[model samples]
Target: MVGIVVVSHSRKAAEGIRDVATEMGGDARVEAVGGTGDGRIGTSPEPISRAIADAADGNGVVVLVDLGSAVMNAEIAIEEAELEEEVVLADAPVMEGALNAAVAAGAPDATVDSVRMAAEDAQRVKKFG
Candidate 1:
């Protein structure tokens, strides 16, 4: 199964999103990472890297980030982790993308590209439609 990492500016938000994703992910590895080391409302690469490493199960990881610095920090985290497993940042909304990716990750045939594509597909979801 593909692993997942949810990155947000608020630790609470990341944990909440991870909770939701986990409900649909079954036993899939989903890690939440947010806020600075000092509990400030910001993103940090260290914790994100740790989360990425923790989430991986010899499979690739799919990262869904919230806004602004989360993206940059996630990128840096991926580089810092220096894992042999592949990691890709999905160009999708943090909440919806995590849900979608989680479901896709649970699939038996799930792969990094497939999970990332599933996350990116969330951009087409209609909430009020």
Candidate 2:
């Protein structure tokens, strides 16, 4: 199964997205990485990477982040780990991408390619509309 990680500045946001995705995806692998420095759920690159690695196992990972910092941190984590699992940092809007990924994951033929395509399509819609 495809693994998805949602990174945001707020824990609630990450959790909320995960909940929605889970409802749609049904048993899909979903994790959260929230920013630190506040009372909210927080995490660093290392922990996020570890979560991604663990969820990925051997399949692959798709990371969705809220902002520039979150994206950068996730990227750094991916680079540092050098994991074999294909990691894709989605440029799509957080909620939309997560939902799209969830839908893709629900498919019996879900693959990294399909999930990436869903993410890209979602991003395009967000960008255009």
- Model number with the top TM-score: 1
Whole-model lDDT for model 1 versus the true structure?
Answer: 0.94
Model 1 ranges with Cα > 4 A deviation: none
Candidate 2, which ten residues in sequence have the lowest lDDT sum?
35-44
**All candidates' TM-scores?**
0.97, 0.86
lDDT of 1 by residue, 23-93 (tens): 98777789999999999999989999999989898889999999999999999988888899999999999
In candidate 2, which residue pairs clash?
A: none
RMSD after CA superposition, every candidate: 0.8, 2.6
| C-alpha lDDT of all candidate models, in order | 0.94, 0.80
